[model samples]
Target chain A: MYRYDEFDERFVRERVAQFRDQVNRRLSGALTEEEFRPLRLQNGLYLQLHAYMLRIAIPYGVLSSQQLCQLAVIADKYDRGYGHFTTRTNLQFNWPKLKDAPDILDLLADVQMHCIQTSGNDIRNVTADQFAGVAGDEIEDPRPVAELIRQWSSLHPEFSFLPRKFKIAVIASQADRAVMKSHDVGIRIVRNKAGESGYEIFAGGGLGRTPMVGKRVREFLPKGQLLAYLEALLRVYNLEGRRDNKFKARIKILVHEIGIDAFRDRVEAEFARADAFSDDENAELARISAQFEVRNYEKLSARSETFEAARKSDPAFAEWVAHSLFAHKVDGYAAVTISLKPVGGVPGDMTSDQMRFFADLTDRFSLGELRVTHAQNLVLPNVKQDDLHALWRELGKAGLATPNVGLVTDIISCPGLDYCALATARSIPIAQAISNRFADKARQDEIGPLQIKISGCINACGHHHVGHIGILGLEKRGQESYQITLGGDPTENMAIGELLGPGLAAGDVPAAIERIVGVYLDKRADGETFIETVKRLGVSEFKAAFLAGAQNEAA
Target chain B: MKLLDRNGFRTDDFSRAGADGAARLDAVIVPFADLPSTAARAGKRLGVDIPNTVTVEQLAPHFEKLALIGIAFPASTDGRGFSLGRRLRRAGFKGLLRASGPLIPDQFPYALACGFDEIELPDASAARQPESQWLQALGAITLPYQRGYARPSSIFEQRRQARKEAAHG
Candidate 1:
């Protein structure tokens, strides 16, 4: 965890004071709503359906225990008893008075956090892999670079008002846990043939009413030039990106219109003119990197015997070990994922008490550090292997010990019509129905790794585009319907799922999913996964089964 | 001949005449596209021969002859003109750098740092007061771009090295 230095602290404090005055002006009628909308949005306050929703930034999905406790306090004091963690690794409080938002921002600034650039048309919070420093397979931790970008893009004068909201994600490993391919700008950290780490930049990727996979703009950009390259790309986008139609205003549309070759040429020309690469940028990066150096770990011998004995004595513990535990670079340590989706609860809601419990547990079992994954789960990155038994006991007592990571029931859902003002149909009910359908533990284990993502609208907040079985909610003639898609995956081999015939009524959506799974079970070859089976058998078989029931109803 | 400040008090020695009278060369601020018409009228009537300049354009062409250059800020938050002022100074423009059109006193330090010599505040009473604590808290801080210019003297380098070594120790 990087503590805020004096400069960082002062910056956030000044920004908070600035926003406080803006809010006062808006309330006093000195500033009209039209004039104040972008300012408030840049501070992460949105005028929603019934009230204002304030999204607090959780940079790079990393949190200290103190910060988590502060968030719990915010939820208890100002909002409903819980807050919803979003796919961008931010948190949204659905209820906050417009006047009280400044106070909330003031409190967040005390803890080295602010809501700046969480929304509106600007460079948004930069996201990276949740397990950046602790993951064993990483080329290098990407958080230092992510922090540099966070500092550079915060309240940038030249680019505060862009054509549309822009998102950037970075991944340092071969396995794409951050879904870098679907962002507006994706940077993959890799080593070149000469054994030096650098980035492979991708451009023009996004998902909304339109979906695209980013194209490779630079095959191997030297690490020293990351900030300069990004400046050039953003300058080009800000100057020439379209403002004609709101729907066609993203950088993705601009890149598509100009063609990748011509866009690259323009970016190169702008890069030449900007003089972006200076010694100051390198010094800033070095300072940020020093703040993120790995903490000291106690040397301990690997205790396979104790772990094996505990697993042999308890079947429940064995099941948990199979799913919750991940390998670590260090010998006697492990990465533990705390699943938020227990049987039928809300996808990413944690009670204030549960948050406190996790904070305490992180201080005890882990190194007082927590990571929030884009899948809406939390990570205890450096938990010692020998302390697994005690951690499992504490987690079980707090109801945070769900032994279903990446299982069919560990769904990734959004706060749908129940909370979001942009939603057109109910997503929580559909998610609940499906979870209840697969409530049998044995059935879930047998189905193995399946990702069921549901979104209430085409905005894809739930990331239904990348799910293995994606369900998108829509309102068809005053009735809620869910459209199912098959074979979408968000890993390195990313692909958008295909639509499986007509949409199903809300009540019938779970049964339709069961039928599709049943078809997969019948047609799967030996040891073939659901994705592989779908690839081999194609969508025709599943489409026939899905549409057969709809035809019968039509008849 | 005088111009009104944002508080409706006279400050600068420039005035705008009506359409019936001939324009004077005390210094007039006009848009970039109206330069040719203003210049022709000034040459015809006042015979106050000086090069006429437009606000918010490249200053390279008028750097030598112009005594005053007006830079326009369309809105308070739009800061493109600040960069323009910096560019003009970097190109060796030492004339009167006047900021015009919606410029405010709260942005005085930033404008001054970017090389603006005078501010042509708008003539609105409500815009006269300092909006917030921005003025009270305004002070100099180390800018990211300042190091590029402060490196010619060896004494500066020695002081920087001493500070670095002390911090490391």
Candidate 2:
């Protein structure tokens, strides 16, 4: 959790006042809708179908218990008593009034949070591995660098109005939990052969209408040159990125058209011109890193007698063992994932009361440290093994202790037609239906690790493109249909899912998913996971099972 | 229509001296259609010969030639022209900048920060309302290529080094 310095605090305060004036002008009819639209968007306010939506940045998905509590207060005070965590690792208030937005921003500023650059054609909220600090395989924690980038890109003068939105992701681990390869700019912290820590930079990766895996632009950029390298990259894109058509404006398209070699040449040339690193920037990053230091853990025995006894007696704790836990870097501690996807509940959503409870739990069991994973679930990174049972009991009451952290029913979904104006069909209902279909805990456990991602539209907010079984909601004529894709994964071995034959109507989508999962169950070898089955069987088999009925109807 | 220069003076300052102690000069008030070409031709014909200027309904088209431009803020908080002034400076057009027509002293610092060299207050009463009150307030004055310009030792690099030192120390 990086604390705000004097400069950071002042910047956010001034930005809030600036937006407050803009809102006042718009409300007074001094600014037209066309004129005020971009201004409002730059401040993270959107005019959705029903009400104004405010997307708040949770920098690199890190949050203190106090910050989470503040967010809960914002939801209760201004929104519909709950907030939706996004795939980008930020949160959105689905229902905010246009007038109260400034007040909400003011409140956010008080807690060192803002909606700045959360949307619009500017550098967006930087995302990174949620378990950056505590992950056992990490080279270093990447949040300090992420915080530096956050500060540098905030309301940047030249890059504020880019051809399209830019997204950057950082990963400090070899496991690639942050999905760094699927971002506009992906940075991985690595140690060179000489044992000096540096950054391995990737460019031109994105997911949207056109999906691409980023190419390596720099093999090993020195740690101090991160800002200079970024400046060169953005400068080239800002000047040369296509603004003629909205669809063809992303850096990925530019990279594809020019070829990665030529793009690399140009970026390197630009980097050479601006090769200097300033002392001020280094000093600032140093200050930021100091704020992110992990709390010292007490030396303890490797074995936990209490935890072993509880797990032996409790079946619920046993179930939690199979799904909800991950090995921590320290001995006798574990990272506990709090699943928001209770069967038949909305994905990535937490009620106000639940948020407050999470705040308290993080303080008590996790050393006031919490992380929002890219999967839209919360994590308690350093929970002692002895405290797991008590924490699980408290979480069970809040509907968060589902014991299905990475299991089949823990679906990733977006607020599709229910909240998004661009959505052609509803996504929440489909997610709910699928969750209900697999509501039985025994059935879910039997199915094993299956990621079912649903997106309301092609925007892939639900991360449908990276799900084991991806369901994309589309509208044909006046009816809703779901186009399914198979074999997408967002882990270290990332791959975009391939679409099956024809889409299924809304009524048939759930059954179609059941048929596909059933096909996996039948065809899988002994002790194989869903992804393994998909990898071995490929899409043709799933396609045959998914579209068999549609083919029959046509015949 | 009174055509004012960047220094709040009439165009007659270098041409015909003020008659009856009131500034008057030969100025062409062009319509929106003829503003650009006419301003260019006027700049060519005048060639710094006499104190001659052209005024138009909009300033965006003639930003390159006019040493001094006047923007009618129309009403209070009409910020389209404020953007115009900023763009002019960002585009590297450093000349006499004037903001007139319904503009007040409250927006003085913003106008100045946006590259307006001079501001034409409506009258003496508007000008007398404590210019210092708004003058001292700082405005965001950033270079056009601030993000693009990569100096060898930048703020981000400095911050990074500082962090390393603190961590190791």
Candidate 3:
């Protein structure tokens, strides 16, 4: 966990003061609503359907226990006693009053957090793999670099107002847990031919109105030149990206319009010309890396007697461990993913009590730090294997022991029409219906490794484009209709899911998903995943099955 | 409109004239679109009022003869002018760099940091936000993080300097 120094503290405090003054001016009618709109948005306050939604930036999705507790206090004090975690690993409060926004930001500043750039057209909060440092397969911890980007992009003088929102994701593994190829910029830590670790950069990948997978802009960028290259990229985008239509403003659209080669050439030219970069970036990196290197583990055997005994005795505990535990970098620890996707619950919504309890659980079982996964789950990054069962019991007490990480019922969803003004249809109900349909743990296990992501609109906030079974909700003729797409994968082999058939009524979505699963089970070769089966057998079979299910459900 | 620089609010000496006006040696600024039409009067005290999207390549030839260049912000939130100003300075434009629009007090420091010599505010904003508030906003951020800006230097540079001094000591 990175702590704020005097400069960082002063920076956040000044930002809070600035926002408070803006809010006061807006209240006093000194500033018109039109003028205040971009200001509030840059501070991450959205005028949602019911109320103002304040999105707090969990920079790179890492949070200290103290920070989580402060968030809990804010949730209890201002919001509806709960907050929803977004697909970008941000926490969004759907009901914060406009008057209380400045106070809430003041509270956030009490910790080392603010909502800056969370929803603005500028470069948004940078994201990285949830399991950044502790993952067994990591090439290097990406937190230090993520922190670097966080500071550099904060209130950036040159790029404060971009054509549209830009998202940057970093990952250090071949596993691609952070949806690297689906961001505007993706930085993957890789070793070049000389065996020195550098970045393999990708550009223009985004999922929204028009989904695009990023193309490799640089084969290997030296770690030292990351910020300089990013500044060059931002400069080119600010200068020439489309501003005629707001929808066609993202850097993705620019790359798609001019083609990647020309974009690369322009960016390289700007990088060569721009010479205002800092001379002590390595020293700054060393300072940041030291914060992420605070892993303290007691020397213990790889095999935990207590963990094995609990697994052998309790079938429930064993099932939870099998689904939720990830291999850690240390021999005697396991990174536990406490799933927010409970059966028949809204995905990624955590109650204030759950936040407080989870905060305490992190301090007790793992380090005092945790991560928010892009899948809308919480991660205990360095939980000792010896304390697995005790921690599991504590988690079960708070309903955080869902044990459905990457399972069929573990769906990702947005706030949808229930909360979001942009949503055309309801997504939470659809997610709840689908999760309840596949509620049986045994059935979910039988239908293994299925991701059913639902979005209330085409903005893809739910990341439905990357789900194995992508469900997009659209309003057709005053009725909610859901479109299904198959073979969507979020891993290294990223592909935009293909549409299965015409839109089905909302009531038919879960049954349609069940039929799609049947198609996968029947068509899959031995030991093939659902995505593998969809790729090998193609979406045609799934489309046939889906249409048949629609007819049957209607009948 | 009033001109705000580090020296405080001042009166403007130049007039914004159209391309149809006869070229004179007096300080006259025209819209950037009219630069080609006014190229014949290059020896005059010519200036260009350009949008933020204007490229340095377009203005490079006129840098020698131009007395001033004003980049439009249009709206307070549109920050394309900041990068344009930085680019112009880096491209060796030695003339005055002016940010022209309805900019608020908060953006004053950023304008200065991006190589703007002064801010030309529309009359409405100049009256609405007090000059005292503008002065206060100038010192609002005593320390900024990025380098290559005007003093005080970036916080990172300060840290690096401290580290070097410590190493030698």
Query: Number of the top candidate by lDDT?
Result: 3
Tell me, by TM-score, which candidate is best.
3
Question: For model 1, what is the error of residue A235's alpha carbon versus the real structure, in angstroms, after optimal superposition?
Answer: 1.1
lDDT tens per residue, model 3, A1-555? 788888889989888888888888778776678777888999999998888999999999999899999999999999889999999989999999988998999999998899999987888999999999988898999889888889888877778778889899989988998999999999999998898888899999998889999999999987677888898899898888888898899889999999999999999999998664444777788888997796578888888999999999999999999999999888889999988988999988988888899889989988898999888989998899989999989888877788789999889999899999999899999999999998988888887888888889999999999899998999999999999988888888899999988899888888889898998888778899888888898888888988887877778
DockQ of every model listed? Answer: 0.13, 0.09, 0.62
The sequence of per-residue lDDT tens digits that candidate 1 reaches over residues A1-555 is 777766667668777777887777667675556657888899999988778999999999998888888889989999987888888999899898988888898889878888989998888999999888888899988898888778767766446667789999988899988989889999999999999888999999887767777888888987667766887798677656776687888888988999999999978875665544444455566767778776678787766567778889989988988999878877789889999988887888877888888899989988888888889999998898888978898889978788888888888888888888898788888888888889898998888888998999998888888888999998899987789999888877888889998888888888888888888889988888888899888899999998987677668
Models ranked on DockQ: 3, 1, 2
Give lDDT: candidate 3, residue A78. Answer: 98
- A209 Cα displacement, candidate 3 (Å): 0.7
Superior candidate under DockQ, 1 versus 2: 1
Q: Write the per-residue lDDT of candidate 1 for residues B45-90, one digit (tens) a residue.
A: 2111112122234445645545566665666545556555655665
Rank by TM-score, highest first.
3, 1, 2
Which prediction has more favorable TM-score, 1 or 2?
1
**Model 1 regions lying over 4 Å from their true place:** A276-280, B1-23, B26-169
Number of the top DockQ candidate: 3
